[model samples]
Target: MAEKITIFAHVRNICKASIFRICPPCLAALSRILARFHSNTQRQLVLFLNTAHFLTIGVSLALVVAFFLYAVDGRPIKGEDSFASEESEEFLPNVREIVGEIRPGDSLSSSFRSNGVDEEVRESVISAFDGVMNFREMKPNDRYTLTLDNDGTLIKCLYESGPLEVHAIERTPEGSLAAKKLDVALDCRTVKLRGRIESSLFAALAAFKEDAKLVYTFADIFASKIDFNTETRFGDTFELVVEKYYKNNEFVGYGKILVARYNSKEVGPLEGFYFDQGGKSAYFDHRGYELGESFIRSPVPMARVSSGFSYNRRHPVLDIVRPHLGVDLAAPMGTPIMATSDGRVRFAGWKGGYGKQIILDHGGGYQTYYGHLSRFAN
Candidate 1:
């Protein structure tokens, strides 16, 4: 009875909505029939709405899931992935070969042959290097390195001659070559050294661990007039400007002595000048006089001033006191002595008490003689 009553109430609510309106008896009978149909239509409408909403939500969720999986699997969309991959491939470097350093004294042909480089390639690289570096001037033990690209074009060529000078050659975009000069910037240094007369000039300057080559060069420049060993006073001072090479903030090596001033105790201020004149480089004095004179004084390079000029000196072999005419440069028996002045070979034979001697008559009464020579110079 309760179920029948609830169904009748639901039918009254559905039919009252103007779907049916008629007389009392007829309306009452039709109302029961229409109520039954209206109740059945309500149930079907509720089921259809729930099924349609479920299908819409399920299809939306599946589309979202499929998009996530496709992104993760790296599928190409609009072919963007393939185009990106091809772009990366274009930038990859194509290495042709690896070559080692070309040491000095290595012929171009031999060096390239060892590195598996062809003759034509070697000739091209050599031609490029010649424009910047003089290959003939290369010394033994100098360093050189080479590299190539995919098209057999030289990529990089590095050459190191000294601590300061380096040559770098690289290819340009126009398929030509370019050169860069990388000279280690020189560090200027001014130092003052003073000492008493010692065993040798090098020994006196030993307090400063200077470049021996530079010191020797300095001595040679002033060897003609100033005698560092004999003529140097006890309080003589030397001021010099030495060029040093510093790499990565550490001292590596030295260049030429750019400027040097030696105030000799006896002689006045002696200065050395290095200048480039008419595209040629040379050393000279402030007066433009070339530092290279006609002749260097001492034949033997600064071993020592063994003996000085004297009127009476006992001979070692003769064991008798005699007037030594010229300065006795006591060196090893085999040491070659040079001619102090440039003159014709007026005398190059044996003389009394002067064994195997050479006498160069420099005109006037001033003639230089080198005695006890192992071999006469040509």
Candidate 2:
């Protein structure tokens, strides 16, 4: 019995050693299979949730698009249908404005015809301006404005001939046009202009932005005392109290020189004040002396004395030394020569050496001779 027990115990010990060695690899294989199964299961669960969430978002976007299209197609835009329904609505008379300057060789009739005015309307307009304006004297560059209806019916016409004058024509109630000349009501503002003679009176005034017309008027105001042509010195200064006209805050023109003061280096300080007395306007000095002399020193305004009165002088064309009795005033060839003083024409023909001359005899012993004239005044 002892030997049998020994053999059984030895077999049992051998079987226990084999089980311990094999159990290690079998347990490791089982753990790897369980880990792989858990990884695949988690991956499938994440994919399913992501696909379901995308499907839900895509369905919501499609529904929102469908709702937008359905809402826009349900109603029509406002004001689109009202335009055709109100076809017979009376609007304010459609006014068309035409503004332009008169071109060269343009007549009033031609201007009206070219601007789509009817024949009868043109004739009516011409008749309207018959006593008001001289249609024949319409000059180029004259600005005009015509107001008309949409059907080319004339409403109002305005012709601005000068800065201060306007000719207006309006359609009357009797279907005829009536014309009237309107002097633009000017707001006279007293302005003082001071300048020193640099080169010329015109240049000095022009530097001050004075109008050319104002310059001529200023020279005329002081014509008796100051010779604007050759007597203006470099340091000569002048102050003018002038009446400048304005319309709608825009300078229109000049009215008159109220007072003028001129200080010359050649001549002394001369002053003139305009005054209205005895139903006539005249300029007077500070001492109330009348500046208007019976005879103007120069026959032509702003003309220079080319040759003064002398016993011996050389002729320009003749090239001969002779006696020059009268002052030779230099002017343009076709310049209009006015009588220096109120006198009768003594001789109005060509003289010996003078080309074309006019001899005016005053009632007194003074006789004025105007030589090198183009023609005699009527």
Candidate 3:
């Protein structure tokens, strides 16, 4: 019995020494292997692996197994280096962008709602534009764009009201909404146009793609001398230097007529230059003479003369010989009548033969009369 006890004690001491020496390297390697596993189930799987096979496999092979297990679990490993990465993945939300146009009978609320925006976000957007813009003034074909987060929060919005005006609203860094009005700049370039009167002045201008406003301006500049309704003849030519506005190389509209020249058959040639003096702008001839006249030739534009001035004429209805002093102009009923010259109203009421008449008294011997059956201008 004494000999058996000594042999057992020696074997136990040898086993303890072997375990102490092997644990250090094996524990270090196990910690690295376990470092790749995040969940408890994966760590248990690693422990269940066959011991003989684990000893034969290299560290790279063990790492590959750990990666495969981590992928199947689909959970990120938590460590001191993962806080920033986790936060980055957590804060970014899904975003969506949409553009909407105002149609007939469509309001700002309807536009947002139709685009799948939440009701709460729509109301907040309306409140954001409260004092900045009047939704009632929104016109048809006006466009707007919206940017929203996954939670349906409005992050940014842009409203294009016109070619030159833009309204913008966005969430500020302080978590408050801010709105502003932006004006788009335009590039202005001067262009010269020359055309001859073929059928009519408006037709001639239209052939060259000139704006109708430009034609009206040309007639107004030469209204006193040339009667566009009757005096314009074939082959009469005109030239103009005007301003054209553009944005991003796209034409927008016209600005003003700088210089105008008209060669009329009746009135040889006329040239007008625009000048600003003492905050007042006026058209002048080459000799510095004002082109404006004391009175306009015709009060109504494009009206035909029904009867001319005659010393002795027979009345159509009464069939009596009488003297018609003023010329009679025939026009549509309810058509507006303008004063031939700038003068105060002397009389505006009903007369015997004339239904509704307005008589103006120019200071001198010159006096004009307008007779019609319509309402008077205020």
lDDT of 1 by residue, 141-191 (tens): 666677776877678877787666698888888878788778666565444
lDDT of 2: 0.75
Question: Among these predicted structures, which one has the highest lDDT?
Answer: 3
Model 3 Cα lDDT, one tens digit per residue, 1-378: 453343334333433443233354554454455455555744454445433334545665788899889956866667754676788988878888889999999999988888887888798888989999977789999999999887778899999988876899999999888988877899999999998987788888899887766776777776667667677788999998989999999888778788999898877798888888899888888898888666766676555678878988898888998989888888778655657777777888999878788888877777788887588755
| Least well predicted 10-residue stretch by lDDT in candidate 2 | 13-22
Cα deviation of 284, candidate 1, in Å: 10
Which has the better lDDT: candidate 2, or candidate 3?
A: 3
Candidate 3: 10-residue stretch with minimal lDDT? 11-20
Name the lDDT value of residue 348 in candidate 1.
80
Tens-place lDDT per residue, model 2, 1-378, is 453343334333433433233354554453344344444653454355446556766787899998778657854334654554355456657898877677799998887778766797678777878899987778988888888887878799899887777999998899878899986777889999998888887888898788877776777666778677777889899899998889888988877799988898887898989998788998888998888566765656666687888877887789999888887788768666656678888888988779788888998698988777777655
The candidates, ranked best first by lDDT, are 3, 2, 1
Alpha carbon deviation, residue 160, candidate 1 (Å)? 1.5
How does residue 159 of candidate 3 score in lDDT? 95
Off-target runs (Cα >4 Å) in candidate 3 are: 1-86, 93-95, 107-137, 170-180, 277-279, 296-378
Please tell me which model should have the higher lDDT, number 1 or number 2.
2
Native-to-model Cα distance after best TM-score fit, residue 315 in candidate 3, in Å? 12
